[model samples]
Structure formats: structure tokens, C-alpha cells
Target: MSEISNNFLYEAIDEDIASGKVKADEIHTRFPPEPNGYLHIGHCKAMIIDFGTARKYGGKCNLRMDDTNPAKEDTEYVDAIKEDIKWLGFDWEDRFYYGSDYFEKDYELAVGLIKKGLAYVCELTPEQFRTPEYAGNTTTPAVSPWRDRPIEESLDLFERMKNGEFPEGKYTLRAKIDLASGNFCMRDPVIYRIKYVEHHRQGTKWCIFPMYDFAHPIQDALEGITHSLCSLEYVIHRPLYNWVIENVDLDYKPCPPRQIEFARLNMTHTVMSKRYLRALVENGVVDGWDDPRMPTLCGLRRRGYTAASILDFIERIGVSTSNSLVDIRLLESCIREELNMKAARRICVQKPLKVVIDNYPEDKVEYFSVSNNPNDPEAGTREVPFTRELYIDAEDFAEVPPPKFFRMKPDGEVRLMGAYIVKCVSIEKNEDGSVKEIHCTADLEAGNGNPLDGRKIKGTIHWLSAKYAEDTTLVLYSHLFTLENVADIPEGKTYEDYMDPNSALRIEGAKIEPALANAEAGERFQFVRSGYFVKDTKNPNTFNRIVSLKDGFKA
Candidate 1:
């Protein structure tokens, strides 16, 4: 766990330590995510920073569930978020917390604000409350009519709000910051909104919930977090994050936690919003959160991405200040680098074309030794069964060959991967004039490493013997969206308009090596000429395409 790059945030941390505003070995942080949906890759950057920063400074980081909004919160999301964080190698130990757990204390904090007259209950409708107005050539917030309500009346209403006597949105507690302030968040932002929905953790004890901007800072300081780390989108909310911590009566030891922002991950070809992601699932545009084409962590994991590879990606794309779009190819490149060294080599022919070794082996069967991984010596070799009938990829052969095409055609000579050189004799056609099968003769003198025939074989193709092959399903995946930055859609059209209709394709009756029959979940392999693949956890004898072999990223 090397320290994250020394950027503006870390520089600020340095100053905090040098000036003694922050003590030595006290740089605590937290990865506080709302329990709403599955964590996406963008969340990984936050995970790396919070956990990595704490480890760097000899401090601790807490894992907190910001389960304030009871309407959409669920224990399932909490569990999934924890699983994703743990999978990235962060352990919060005993510091797991939820913002709703502080409901009583938050109410008491509001009580203190009410006593100091720093906060008041408001009855403004959302339109009236958030309406923008111009005053003296400057943007001004429309002040709530209830802003000047008597202190006792506001306190009683807030108490009543807690007792579930008020309908949702009938009342809310607003921090009494300046309405004329330039920052919109400081314009008497609502900190507590009435929500009648049941909380995943808190149950029916409380009807009012804390806003994220209000609850997060309180949770951070309560946990004694030194640096409140978050994405750059919260830069505007940082002022409010500080405001809550400053005004709230707390027992924090050193000082209130400091909020720092860095650029959030934005990438091409995928949408990050939970609303849209859920739509994709509900609309059946995607299978679920774990669909190989999805950008969710579970989806990536199921798509054969390794935890180490994801961490490596975080390292490759260091933390920064300004938000920018990163090419998704970089992500694919990172996983490719990892699987290139770790994934074992195997042979599987999709869209199989029948090949018969006409002259040499009509009734004979032989085993040819193939290297498990040419890049890894310790991987050794495995015996590949060779029989009279075998299946190669249809794409590896050409009825009317393209320019300089070196693979099998009429009278064309090519190597049979790790086996022997083969020369195509003739082809058989179907009613549609498509080549249904190919006839070839294996050159017995051109066996593996013992080639007596001196003619050079330029192209080599992978194949599986029909006698020993296993029927498998091959899943091919493409980008989920057809356009980059799916967030910026054509005005009137929905996100489904840009979705790639053929993102996930299933091809049954694929030919794979018999050894793959015993492969367990998460076992990865390179399908010879094809891309890396992993066995699907939910479907037996099915493999999900992890990534294509195209290395799009520059070294």
C-alpha cells in the first residue's frame, strides 16, 4: 500500500501535520457510501484513497453506511457495499457505522442548534424554498416565510416531526446559514427532511432523516476522522460539511474533520447514476448488476477482473483535482496485463468448423503436449487429445480468401496450433453454398518440434477434437453503451436509446477442452486466439468473455 500520489489534498494533509492542526499518526479517514445500490468502479478510487491514506499515516479508516434516506436504503445494498470494499482489500475492523444510528444524537444536535437559534424548522414547499431570485444584480435565494418562526414553535414542530405526526415533506429543519451567500448550499439548506419510509437499520423508531450533507460530517467527526475524503463533486458541499461539524456540539478530540475533494472517476461508454443503472436492470437491458457488460464491481469480478488488477488500475490513474474523462481502454488494458501472466492457456473453438484428417488417422487417436502458458514456465504442459475429426473456428478458414490471408483455404497449408501441420484438401458445402465442413490431411512428418517437412507454416489455428470436446456456452460482451459519456444523452431520448442492443451474446454448442469440465467458478483462462474468459458462476458449462485481445492502451 504505497501512499497515493502527493497531490493538492496530500499537500494540505502535510500542512495540517506541520502546523500541528493534525497530530502525528492521527490521519483518520472513512469511506462513507450510501446504502442505495451496487458500488461502481468510480467508487474504487475513493476506496483506494481512504484506506490507502490511513495506512500511509499509521491511522485508521472507518467503513460507514450513510443510510439516511430510508426511502431507497436496504440491507442488501449495505452488504454488497461492504463486500465490494472488502474485496478491494480494506478492513474497517469494528468501525462500521450507519448515519441513521445517530438519529437520537442528531435530533439532540438539532435541539442544540434550535437553542442557539442557528437552525429553524421551515414549511416552505420545494418550489418556493429552492426558487432562485435576482437582487441588486446578484443571485439571491428566496428566504423561507417560516425562517423567522418563534424558537419554541420551531422546536415543538421538530419534536413533532420526530414523533411521525407530520407527513413526509410537510416540514424540514434548515441550517440558518445566510440566504444571500454566494454558495447555494449555504442558503439555509435543509439538513433534516421528513421521510416516513422505514430505514433499513433504524426501523420505525424515527420518521425524520438527516440529509447526506448534514449526516456525513456529523458521522465523520463522531468517528474522529481527521480527513473527510470524498469525490470532487462534493466540493460545493464541503462548506456545508464543515458548517455542520462546526455548529454541532461534539466530543471530537483534536478538531472537526477537514473535507478534501479529488476528481471522481468518469469514463467512456458507461453510465454511473444509480437511477439509470436500475432502469437498465428493470427494463431488461442488462441481466443484472453482475452482467459482464455492467460497470459494477461484481460485474467486473464476474467478467474475470482480478482484485489486484483493479488496484493496479487505481495506481495507473492517480488521484487528481479536475474531473476528466478517462478512456475505458485503460481499464481493459490493466485487466489484460494481469490475465496475461496469471490466466492459464486453453483451447476453445467458437463457431466450430469440422475438419477431417482424411488420409493419416481414420481410427487412430493421439495426444499432443501443449504449453499451459508460454509466459509462465511453472505452468508446465497438458496433453491435448487429437483425433481424426476436430473442430476449428469458421473464421479461421476462408471460402474466398482475403488479401494475404494465411489461414486454411483450398490447398492451403497451416499449422494445427500445438499439434501438426495440416494442408486443406477440399471443402464441402451446404444448400446455401456455405462451407459446412473442411477436409484436410495432417503432415505426419511435420509433428510438434519434430518437423521433417521444411516448408514454412505461417499461420497457426487452435482446434478441439470432436471425440474429447465438451459442449459449452460462450458469452461475448461489448460495451454497454454505444456512445461515450452516456450521461450526455440527446435531450428528448431516454438512456435506452444509446444502449448497445447486442452487449451480451450467447453462443451455445461451443467446443472446449475436456479439462474445462472441472473448472470451478472464477477460474480464468485464455481461449488460445480468443480473449480471456472465466466460468460463469450461475451457469454451468458457460464462460463469460472477460476482454478482447486488442491492446488499445499505449505503454
Candidate 2:
């Protein structure tokens, strides 16, 4: 059995179970995502609460698609949502469902309210009703001209609206809850609206659709959900959610789903709004919703983040009722720590500078033993090829050495990582003064150990044998947006204004160890001194840098 969570959400559930309000074995939750766009990190938290809480109690959680608004809903997003949830180690079992599955029931519940004199058909459009003449203030309640329409007339007009009788937005069915209440949602809110669009699943079977606040509760109650866990934004809407449950007649009466609010996950350096994300895709600022720089789950996965690292980050953050911004570096640290112990080590030269071991036999080749992962004793070691000609990262060498620089310098000694200690003898340069070939003589007898003369070598640099290296592509990524929090963009500035143009950099013809050539797509590796990377699933011989080896987060 899973351990019990000490968070407020679980505490409340514990209280409910203690009071017999909810049977411990009957604890049920759900993750209902609208099928419009890809799931972002924000959704991951909700998934954890819904599925994790259920797991804690050995209960069940449903994966329901809140595909209420069909304007942009598609099976494409639906499939992606399921894949993402499953990738995060969650399973809804046999309880998969769509919001449209209860459309007929939603319509029936609205009609039931009309017959009971608790609802009426409103003729005002949203624009007209939101005006001062109709919208009420703290001292006054909003007025609806059709609030008192006869129940019989309302029943007929609602039926006609559903039968495609009126054009879109010409009529609506609103609940007659309160006209002078402080809560605007209870002030004769429209429960249903007319939309002349085809539903992704329902087709054109109906024209009028129930709004989210109205449909969500009904779906929850019907599904026998005991706890409705949602983001903190819905705390104010809880009143309307309960009002719907109390007024509308339903079969699952004794135990309606209790709504609990928790803070949403807000991360630094990225925007989670679907509208802004769509604009980025439509405007060609990003490759797509799955762009590595995007915060979408698929984007993170493609960028080399494993489910374990993301869950670890979430666990460290814990659950809170108040809103806060999390530094992206915390997320980077999690992946770095996991990959350091798990990912196999490899050699990659981003900007290759040729090196020729002059004293090494030209016709001879040797192999050096290197640990696949130094932190894992069971990982064992692999043999790395060493030849007369090799390539090292250009940054590792300095024609002019910087202060305290331990790497290669003029006539300086450095170890060709996992091989022999070598000292630079001469360098060949191009016309522009760029390094072409660095000539060195290796201490063949040292063999990846201290020099026989007891000379100390501080620099150890990764290198790939020229004959055994393969050309590959490397894509480096940075923050998607320049701003730390796109949620609070400066006034008069759009999210697009903060888009970082250099978020992703692609380098071609980078050299990697030949063994890396056999790595399948999605395989992860640590490139020695560089960051962890994954072979791009869509591109052959290409790797995307996941996170740098450095951890900027202090904690």
C-alpha cells in the first residue's frame, strides 16, 4: 500500500473518511483535461493529486476528457493527453470517458431546473448583459429581462435552441439562482449556450451545450467521484458547483463529489496559456507544441527529461494552497542528478580541433577502458578507441591561455581523457588564426595514470578518435522566454515580446564516439564534461541537450 500524504488535500479526505462522509474504499478522484492543446507542467501537478491521492487510498481515478468546448477539440489532443498521462506513470484503468458522454444528461438536468421554476430562457447576449444597465454592483444585483419568462415558454425555447431552431447566441438557458447576491456566478448565470459547431465526438447531434461550471459537477456526481480536486482558481466557483448539485436532481445523491482547491503549479521562464502557446506555433516562433523549448510534457520528454526527474522535482516542491513561482533551475538539477548516476558516459566534440599524437605509432591503434557510468558499479566499463589522430573540443584548448586555465596550452601537458598524458608540441593554424591541427607527443607508458616522472596533470579533456568518430547534430536549448515569469508580463507587452530568439541553437557535423552511432532514438547519455542529452526521436544522428551539468539552484 502507498503511504498516506500529509498535505491539506489528504487531510481533508482523511476527515471525510473519519466522519463517514466518504467510505475509505470509495475514495475516487479524476483528472479532466480539455482536449484542445498539449498538457503542460501545470497539468502534471493536477495529475499527481488526482491519481496520486487515489493510489494512496487504494481507490480509483478516472481519466475524463473535459472536451466541452468543441471549437478547437480534436482526437489528436485527446490521444496526446492519454499518452502523456500514461508516460507519467498513471493509469485510469477502464474508466476513460468524454464530457460529451453526458450531454443528454446535462440537457435533461437544465430542463429539470426549468420545470421546477429555478431556471429561465434568457434572450440577452453576453455583451448586452455585461453592461452597467444590466450588470449590478456591490449594492445592486444584475437584472435579466427574461429572468421571469414563464416556465412553459422557457422549456419550449430551450428545446428549440437544442433542436437548432435559433442562430448561435440568440438564446440561452440560465439558472434563476440570485439577482442581488454578491457572487456574480450565482446571479442568473447562463448554464447553457448555443454553438453552431460540430462536436469532435458528438457531431451535430445538438446545438446548445452546457457550460463547464454546469457540466463539470453533473459529470463528477454521475461518475460517483467522491472528491473533485481542482486548481485554486476554482475555489470561488465552488459555490456554484455546490448550488448545481443541491438544486439539480441526480441519482447519486447521498455523496456528491466534494470540491477541494489547491494552488496551480507555476514555473519560471515559460507561459502555460494555450492561447499564447498556439500563437507561438501559428506565428512560427516555435517548431510546434512539441518544440523542445516548450514546457509541454511531450516537449520535455523529447528534450531528454525522464518521468522520474519531473516527479522528483514535484515531490520536492510539495503541495501548497498559496501561489508561488518555482525556479526552472530546480527542475534542471533534478535531471542532472538522475542522469549523472544513470546515463552512460560518451564523448562529443561540439567544435572539433584536430589533434595528432606525433610520438604515437602512426600504424598502431589502442583502446582505453572507461566507465559507462562511474556512479553505478553494475554499469561496468566500455573500451574507447585511441588512434594517432583525434578530435577534441575547441573550447578545451587555448592558443592564449586564460588565468588559472588548466586545459591545453602552448607546450602544456593534458590527459586525453581515458588515455595517455600528452603535451602539445606545435599547432597548425588557418589563415584567420583559427586552430587547424594541434601536434602532441603522448607518454605511451603512462596509460591513463599519473606520469612516470611524477609530473602532475590538472587538465583532463574528452576526445574522440578521428577514425572512430561519427558526425552528428547537437541542438542546445535555453529558456524559451527572456522573462522569468511570462504570467506577469509588463503592461502593453505581449508574451511574444519576451520570446527568446536564441532559445534553441543547432550545430551540425559535431563529432561523437562511434559507439553513440548505435544508440537508438530517445537514448540518454552524459557527454563527459558537457550536459546530458537524448538522441532526437525524429531526427537521425541528432541529440538534444537536456540540461547542463551545472546546477544553478542553491538548494
TM-score of each: 0.97, 0.98
Candidate 1's C-alpha runs over 4 A off are 1-3, 132-137, 450-453
Q: Write model 1 residue lDDT over 364-401, tens digit each, in one string.
A: 88998888988999999999999999999999999789
Clash-forming residue pairs, model 2? none
Q: Candidate 2 local accuracy as lDDT?
A: 0.90
* TM match of model 1 to true structure: 0.97
Candidate 2's C-alpha runs over 4 A off are 1-4
Q: Pick the candidate with the highest TM-score.
A: 2
Alpha-carbon RMSD to native, per candidate: 1.7, 1.3
Cα error of candidate 1 at position 30, Å:
0.5
Find the 10 residues in a row with the least total lDDT in model 2.
1-10
lDDT of 2 by residue, 1-555 (tens): 122257899999999999988887789999999999999998988888899999988889999999888899999999999999999899999999999999989999999999999999998987988787798888888988888899999999999998898998799888898889898888888899999889999999978889999999999999999999999999889999999999899976448889999999898998888888888888998889888999899999999999988888888787889999999899899889999989999889999889999988887889988899889989999998999999999999998898999899889999888788999999998999788999999998888888888988999999999988999999999998999977888889988788778789999989999789899989999998988999998888899999998865785
